[model samples]
Target: MTDEVAEDDYEEVVENVALCSECDDYMEHEILKERKVGTGRDLLLKCISCSAINNLQIREPKSISIPFILTDGPHSARVELAIDEDEVFNIGDVFEEDEMLWTINQILDKDKRKKKTILAIDASSISALRTDMVRVKITATRGEQSDSSSMLVEYGTKFTADTKIDYQGEVWRIRAIHTGAGRTLKGTVESQDIKRIYLHEPPNPEHFEPKTPRERRQAWKEGRLGYNPNPEIPKEITKKRVTPSNKRKKKRPRK
Candidate 1:
């Protein structure tokens, strides 16, 4: 009797939950009754949400079984998924379905089997520079042979005047720093000599220009281009046949 009670205490039904066909959510069910017909047992359950009745059959004792009460002890626990970077998993993507489901299950298990609907998800990465470390936004302008470009740079509090740093595959040294509004500092940087700087760093090349129209057409005909969708118009034209029209009977002028 003691062994039977211990077995009952640890008895858990790990059944694959079925979602509602109407609402597409897990249904809360309670076993209405069970009847033994011949050698098989039939269990009837009614969903609390939709009030829909579902019948389950039990042929073998160990095949599959669901508990009368779907949830165990308490279902109040909440689960949270915090991402420290950009979105790594998309829910609707087929390739990431397994990974997303695995991550969700891990969170649910850790939070005492909480429902997945209440799970909180955060996708933004934590900022490295805090409110105190932020110095000021400075306008950074770089001059090229033909044109000049400018961008707003965020200078941290740790950086000072005459400090060297790398930006956009080029070496730039800070020229000057001035006190700005609200405990901030504005800085300027200038380009240095084009010496052999970085190890294994490839040189930046000019923007690519597409070939001429005649060259592109030749490349397309030789199949050097990417995927081309051809409906095989020539083959289809051979299969098409013009149907003969029936001639109408001409009535006589006297009639």
Candidate 2:
């Protein structure tokens, strides 16, 4: 009788271990145990309802730092810094200590040492002919030889249609329309050394008049001036006459 009682107690313990704690109901549960040779034993509890396993080991968080430098230049300024592959740095932060800062300053100073070239225009002569064609001669000098070019200007207009000019060794095409009072030249640099200049006329509102809506419609209809009527056709059906020889031939074939 005592052996039976001990067996009953053992069975009860096994049944309790197999029951799932999350569901509050009796269900099959798996026991997972991990033990390392150097580390202590670790036991993980897995819930069947959530399907989640608890991590037993605690891990430390890792972080990194980066350094940078900011320097000013003649044309523009920049920030230089040294950063690790894992490090992050914000803008305007200096990290290269003082060495990179001095290097950047020196580069900026050297760039500022460059001298800018100055360009000067000699003179421009405008000539008008009886044929209504106008010519403009322009001479410009930049350091050495004076480059000269000519453009044709139209009369009664402030801007020219198209004109090409060569300055230095490059050619420029004119694509601008000048509309300023007294300065009525439209020009653009066609190439590195050439400029194309043209003349433009001011807006003339008096030259155009708005037409009435009725007049516009009338004009549209009048544009199709010529019309032709289609010929009429009769709808009556016509019957064809049958020849006796043909009818006999058809009957003979059937026979």
Candidate 3:
């Protein structure tokens, strides 16, 4: 009797690395979250050293596995790797001897496997609702107006009009929210600002220009404006007409 080995006996491992700005060294980064965006995977990695945030994109590879059968070899066996009617195989991807080492080299239908755009929503909204700070996957997009932003969350996300969230290093208060019957919900937030700069008209540089002699003197004294005491004219290059290439050419056909 001979012993047999199965394909499920081995484990696969993948390593992800990132650089820490504070530590200035490459460190093993822990993946906080992964979102499918287009044809790649958007990964949020946290530096193990200083806990800094880093973004990484991982694209799909061309390798695809298909089944193959060993017929001419010493052992004629029936396996799942045998070519099926719907499967497509590439050259150099199949081996007659070892089934475990066979590597797929061709790409299948890439468009079908592609995912839609995924937005990284601010996780601080959960904390602002007075809930425990835990990792949550939410889909969101940018707001239409400046100084204000909106986010899309899954249905049943606990929040109210008074909810506060930290987005892009700034704290904002939720102003309005619209919940849908579907699994998605939209929410808007505005900056918690006390005052805003309102202008009647855009300031013109020429209008603010110091036209009067006293204004110009005051400007000079205050170091608000200055001009070059001595300016140097740039030297221009004069192009010289040279003869065309003297290389011989093939004879033209007679008209």
Candidate 4:
């Protein structure tokens, strides 16, 4: 009873489309009728293979530019994001940009009210924090002053107390770990839980100081030091002459 529908002028929507009851799976379908509502499409579709009718409503996706703010520790940068009008974003969802993954922590609706979830059409802005890496704060105490710096470490990196670490072109030992609960002098903690790492600057190692050439000569002449300038050069060897073929220093007492 269905007319030859291809002869009718209807806009076709070709997506890997909706399920068909007769085919019992998704198959090619032709749009018999399509009406565009404010944000959605009401479509009457007939399967090309089985001639079954399916009425479906799909949102017409439109790109909406929303403000996306990315946070890194104390700094933040704002960027524009083009999301589909139908996109629904939830807190704790991850988004990737510039090879970094960020987790959505907050979203603001058009009224600037905080929301746990938001549709792109209603979202005014979104805030996300870096999740793939974290900046670990480091502090080294001197006699009176303290030096503070930060290092970027992979997320969940384990840091243990009394371990040597490299920072600012110097080697430091992790004296303690502040877990935000308390400082621990021993044991391990992951990156996320650590608030700040207390560091101990390693003591300068003692080394032998070689005397200068002038000082060496002066000390040797003063009988205060032994000088060996060319230690690598072999020293001449002198052999003592046999004492007059066997003359005794003093005639041994006759035995």
Candidate 5:
């Protein structure tokens, strides 16, 4: 009886390096010539450090399929991404899929450890969020009158309280932002994480242009009377969440 040898016994490599035949050492080389062979590439290279000539045959980079978890607010879905094994990926990188753009928030390596930077082959899974567009809930108010609406904004749009902004053909000042931590008046919030935005009228309106010094002084006084924005705390909504009764099925009747 004779022992049989395994057909696949060598390690697969994706990097662009090869051993120099003349120097008998692995070294970085400049491509001198290249042509497509039957299943791979036939290439001639010269070592950069030793100036030695070498011949190398290489195959295409292996494809690595990684699990992609995409999220939008409370919704999430799983998808697969096929990337070249030699490609490098980093956090905050954006890629287009399913006709929308997504940004990488985190990556899990082969050991299931989180990482900010990793190679495509080393990444086991990825977490991403929609970045092309985000829906922002806004409330435009002028004391007694107010309008509540939602607007589509870019991912990184910044909103700062106590600043004036033009929206929906009207000028309004931001009053507060509701973030995951809570509502705040003096801090900035991104559009993606902003649950809601509160706004009031701008300090000066076009129709309120003052014709006299006294009118101007009065307008200034009115703008400052109740528009104190120094306080950062916001009133929290203490409403309790009620779970629907339909979540669990009733016990089956016994025969």
Candidate 6:
């Protein structure tokens, strides 16, 4: 008899031959190109098992350049103050444009009397509950009357409220101060704007009683309580009169 090889044995040999490489594994590769400086260069390589182009290289790029400046300290000051024992004010509170300008002027005026100068500062609008902080932009003036020389004021520590401010005879609580963004000061209010304030009395306690569904349905069916108007009824009832008929001449006898 002639020697015979099994199909399974031939299949295994073919599979092993398909992966003939240094790694002895199948894989796919793609080639990437990069131009070299001062020369026309081409780099090429083949994947071992899959025979694919594996000429790609991953290289790190150069670092980016950034500008640096030396400064003595930060450019702003900030503070946080409590309002009416509730709410806190940070940065970025919207206030009336006029009110904000007025507050800034007040700060500058106070600083001026003390021989201190604040170039330009911005204040946020008052909060609804009269609570928020303020940011102040501070700069020193050049000459005795010149507003040229200035420097940013750094917040040494948080300044609490010494006393509340009365705006137009209305008391407002000061929350905090923020001098970070140029010169901005913020203050929180304990009360809302006078015009916007609304007063409402407590609801009557008698309206709080709960009614059962059955009781409500009975009231509706009896017509005692309804949204629509009740139909009108006559005050007095009228009696009706009836008359008997007498039309009988002769009646035939029935068998």
User: Residue 216 of model 5: what lDDT?
Assistant: 64
| lDDT of candidate 3 at residue 123, scale 0 to 100 | 10
Which regions of candidate 5 fall more than 4 Å away from where they truly are?
Answer: 1-35, 44-53, 137-151, 160-175, 180-182, 186-195, 199-255
What TM-score does model 2 achieve against the real structure? 0.14
The reply for model 2, stretches above 4 Å from the true place, is 1-129, 141-145, 152-170, 173-255
Count of clashes in candidate 4: 0
Against the reference, the lDDT scores of all candidates come to: 0.39, 0.35, 0.42, 0.84, 0.82, 0.31
Residue 31 error, candidate 4, Å: 5.3
Q: Write the per-residue lDDT of candidate 6 for residues 1-255, one digit (tens) a residue.
A: 133545435552222122224555654333344555443444444654456554433333332221111112223223332223222223233333223211221222222332122222221222221123222222222224322222222223233233343333444333232333321234322211111111122235555433778756555544545653553232232122333357575988998
Clashing residue pair totals per candidate (backbone < 3 A): 0, 22, 2, 0, 0, 36
Q: How big is the positional error of residue 135 in model 1, measured in Å on the Cα after superposition? A: 7.0
Name the 10 consecutive residues with the lowest summed lDDT in model 4: 232-241
lDDT of 5 by residue, 1-255 (tens): 123334355556545577877777777788999999767899998888788877777888888798999986557999988889999889999999999999999999999999999999888999998899897888888869988888888878988987888888888888899888998989778898899999888666556587788776554555532564453232232123444566778889999
User: In candidate 4, which residue ranges exceed 4 Å CA deviation?
Assistant: 1-59, 204-255
lDDT of 2 by residue, 34-124 (tens): 5453434444556555544543432322332212123221123333333233332222222333333222111111223311221111101
In terms of lDDT, the poorest run of 10 residues in model 2 is 118-127
Poorest stretch of ten by lDDT in candidate 3 = 122-131
- lDDT, candidate 1, 157-202, per-residue tens: 2444555656556656544443322221333322111111111122
Global local distance difference test of model 6: 0.31
RMSD to native for every prediction?
Answer: 30.2, 28.5, 33.8, 14.4, 20.2, 27.1
The candidates, ranked best first by lDDT, are 4, 5, 3, 1, 2, 6
Q: Could you give the candidate ranking by TM-score, starting with the highest?
A: 4, 5, 3, 6, 1, 2
Best by lDDT: 4
